[model samples]
Target: MCKNMKELQTVSERIFSLEQKKAQKKKEMDELEKEIKMLKNETSSYMKKRQKNELNIAGFTILFTAFARSSFDKDAFIAGESNGAELYRKYSKEIPMERVTVKVAK
Candidate 1:
């Protein structure tokens, strides 16, 4: 019948449209995967906190910053506050072998 033929045609068109949409999504996902892999190589990752130098503590939460630097106490990183940030508790007096910096995450 003509009616049956039309119905079959309509169903075929819908299936083709769905397949097109699925392919588009697959392409988008593949592009995103490539982008993520690229970013991973273009960045630095730290497994644990580490110091930048022997005299500086690198890992400190920067709540605030000002025109100031921490002065050495007894030739060691004792309790020192930077700008309005809290005085980070130093892990050891061995010239800060590890440093960590914290950022406020919204």
Candidate 2:
């Protein structure tokens, strides 16, 4: 038990100080959580943009290759180089390709 008025006042002041500190810490934690959410949203937006750009590039490359094959002579196109040997375009063959796509829920 606090004997004097001064001792009771000191104890009350300490309790008030601790409450203030706890509130301050809670506020800081909320701000940090808000920042993290904002950053995650920004990251998702950037990833979508990057995926769109990559698909555009791939489409352009395929179109360019097809256009080149149709417009130019087969002898002029270099097909592949292996072991210091240069190979020219001879024929076209269809190869199976696997593609994966990601869809986001609204």
Candidate 3:
């Protein structure tokens, strides 16, 4: 019983240490992400001002282009069309999934 308790205590301490490290790394990552976003905005602005779509420098190519994406409105289609609901049910398939998570208390 004493040995088991010691093992549990060791595992719990390891989990706490890992959680602290994870939090520190997350903070560093957030700062880096912010800097990257600022740099990208500056580069994009420069490209747009020069009326350029692509820039090749230091063996890297950056593309700044405009595009349109098409998306279907399921609810609107179902309301507007007579056979929309049936078509949606016929095309859509439900898949079973299992997710596992571990949460440490602060």
Q: Tell me, by lDDT, which candidate is best.
A: 3
Tell me the tens digit of each residue's lDDT in model 3 across 10-81: 988999999999999999999998987777777767776888776666666676764444445454456456
Local error of candidate 3 at 11, Å?
1.0
lDDT of 1 by residue, 4-102 (tens): 988989988999999999999999999998986655333213222331222222553333111233443444444353522232334222342222234
Candidate 1 residue pairs in clash (backbone atoms < 3 Å): 50-99, 51-98, 51-99, 59-99, 59-100, 59-101, 60-100
CA lDDT scores, all candidates in order: 0.47, 0.52, 0.67
By summed lDDT, which 10 consecutive residues of candidate 2 come out lowest?
61-70
* TM-score: the better of candidates 1 and 2: 2
Tens-digit lDDT track for model 2 on 13-92?
99999999999999999999898667655544554555532233323321111112223345545546462223332343
**TM-score head-to-head 2 vs 3, winner:** 3
Residue pairs whose backbone atoms clash in candidate 3: none
RMSD of each: 16.9, 19.3, 13.0
In candidate 3 the C-alpha lDDT for residue 65 amounts to 61
Output the lDDT of residue 58, model 3: 60
